[model samples]
Target: MVSEIHLSDDLGDSNLTVSDFANTLDAAIRTLLEEQSTGLIAGGKISNKLVELEIPEKLVVIGDIHGDLRALHNILKKIKIDKFVLNHNNKIIFLGDYVDRGLGSIEVLYTICSLKIQHPHSVVLMRGNHEAPVEFPISSHDLPKRMTERFGRRIGTEIYQTKIMDLFHLLYLITIIKGELFLVHGGVPTDLSNITMKFNEIVPNETGLFGDMLEEILWNDPRILPDGKDWENSRRGLGKHFSSNVSKNWLSISKTKVIVRGHEPCNGFKLDHDGMVLTLFSCNEAYPKFSVGYISTSGIRLHSIRNGFDLSEMVKIL
Candidate 1:
């Protein structure tokens, strides 16, 4: 039998070899398949698709890291100094796309997994478009190719199966903070209320059990239409690009203040519909500039990590 999930000891220690990763991958896959649960193991924290959080204290929200270990490390270093950010009350929410399109996909996965094991309740990892089980031909940089290049074909394939995509299914697609801020990998659905109740039913596997809704949540984008239209067909040929009015209607209906998402790698950050929607892209290599959002009692503050940590340009979304 696979050993109990215990990669928390490996955090900040990059001593794990590719073979070691393969072993961990095997164990994780066995754990996931056998348990048939959302948490890492049986009776663990987290559920499917939606992680509801109480954001009474400070919460650091990192946008898409892709696979840039450097940027991820930099953000971690800052978090380390803060000291209180990782406490039980607060949280560190990653807005997904943790793998693919960068050099350190495997390392990034290991790091995030370790952190999750260490802080099961405090650390939240959401599912991104790249996190889907099926291969995405659109990604310019394929993670599987990178894995194969690093550990050769056999070990790489094993890693991809268990260590990467399997865990993606366990990730919550939408994380609501204080029933106010909505966190999703992509834009929110036009009809947020209807889907919120049925989100757990939309589990994704190789066959895509609920592929259409999954595609919309993971692939959708936000747009501003001339009239007070709700949604329009996206140019991407995948999901709808919701209009400003759609977002407003959803926010009002859902009783949420703002919607935050990461997918388009939008020049580090983008605010739409008078800041009702915040799009943050945190991969520095793919997108040279990067920023992280902090949700607190004060409001949402966007801090730039481009040259260094600058909080002067913080935007209040409350």
Candidate 2:
């Protein structure tokens, strides 16, 4: 059974220390786990492969956060959905990479989890490649290593296991909104048609699952199709490299109008395959470019961040 939870508002504040996250780790984990259980039970399905959500009146789709709390906060506040805007009519779909590379992975996660607890039905969290543990020699800042550096070995390791690891297991691979939009951390998988998989199938608990469709969803990249092939093996060495033709087929099969994903960074946002796919990067410091997407009756709106976290004009994706 799922339980209701309340976390201190301070957990959502930026510029937090590892100790701050450690103090609230247990409560946050309990709440996140309960939310996952409740959502699964209420959804009438036991699966991790996908999560189906009804498109709310107003929907916001954010790209890779990568532990940038200031960017997250700025985007949320600009859209008036910060810590207090808990209206059920509005929904936020985060494309993942909630940790790694930035300084505030702990606080970024706490804020997201707190939002989930407060608005259980309104927020949808998707799994990203960086969510799981990466091996040594990887370039970016991973959760375990960064936390250990900040909080010492024992406390950091425990905090990671209790607060971060389980949440990664609980996250879904894809979210289908109103049967019109298909959302995932990465692009489509070539093996998506091989199995008679339900909307929600069980996914692997960790990354590095070679050839797993769920892993593909979390790792794939979109590429323009060449002469006659549908897809080629990905250069990333894990997921498949999908082409526009592949995307069209998947869109037709799934009956979704467009695919929105985040994995590769872009100049705020990028439209592909003649507007059938959108890749957005929401973290400003990720590469000095940032934006967020909103799906409304008016179409997809891309809000760019400028002048150190100020909101710019809303550019419609065409």
Candidate 3:
């Protein structure tokens, strides 16, 4: 019922547009990431350095993190997980967009994956649209390599290739929590009903396709502008692809009234459509793009996950 909420569904007889759906999906990624980032910071889980597996007091969700190992490190450090886990337990939810744009995505994901393995039960990893073969190569299809070529040398390539590559296959585009919060890398598609992202557990060669049963977790986002306000993301393909198209279409489908995402950059966490949707970019001051987000049952929060600025509390419910 919660995941069934979408704006497109309300329009019933109307057609869904890819442009709108893309924008909406992008925004959704940011929203969920914002939820995960600080949630990890406010970790109230019960894991020990030597022990494994424990219950969680809260869920820490992270937003889109391009290959910025530095920003990723900062986010992990900034999370006040210990503070939250004092009485309540907690878990970490990574909402996808883990690769591309920045140089260190390969390492970033591996680091997170390492954490997931170390803290197994406490970590949740979702897949983003960029996790495909087109994203990992050292050539043109790979933005991580391109960014690295412009920046400097990365610490480890083989480690990322071997260790992190395995996790990529196991990630999901969307991850729903307690059946209350819908977490996806992209926005939902119209007619998305009873769809689920099984990324909480990582396995080899598992995947979801695009269509009525679209990869909502990896495909959804919030609308870029207010109702009747047009927005264009040149960075994306002429505002027709998921960057703009699909988002609008999906927004109209869900019944939740509002969607969240992590693909775009915002001066800070933002709300549009009279609060119908929320957008939060998790990395700040990242090489090319940066944004971070934090979300919880109470509300959503935003923060800057970059090096220039010390990791600070971007968003907090309490």
Index of the highest-lDDT prediction:
2
lDDT of each: 0.63, 0.63, 0.43
Q: What is the C-alpha lDDT profile of model 3 across 35-149, one tens digit per residue?
A: 3333332233111100111223555666777675555555565564434323324566676677776655544544564454334445666666676433323231264364334
Please report, as a residue range, the 10-residue window in candidate 2 with the lowest summed lDDT: 303-312
Runs in model 3 lying further than 4 Å from the true structure: 1-56, 81-89, 133-166, 191-207, 210-220, 224-235, 238-258, 287-292, 296-318
Query: Which sections of candidate 2 miss by over 4 Å?
Result: 1-20, 23-25, 40-49, 82-84, 133-141, 192-211, 289-318
lDDT of 1 by residue, 148-180 (tens): 877889977787766666777666677676445
Q: Candidate 3's error at 128, in angstroms?
A: 1.4
TM-score of each: 0.76, 0.77, 0.53
lDDT of 3: 0.43
TM-score winner between candidates 2 and 3: 2
Q: Is candidate 1 or candidate 3 better by lDDT?
A: 1
Compare candidates 1 and 2 on lDDT and give the better one. 2
User: TM-score for model 1?
Assistant: 0.76
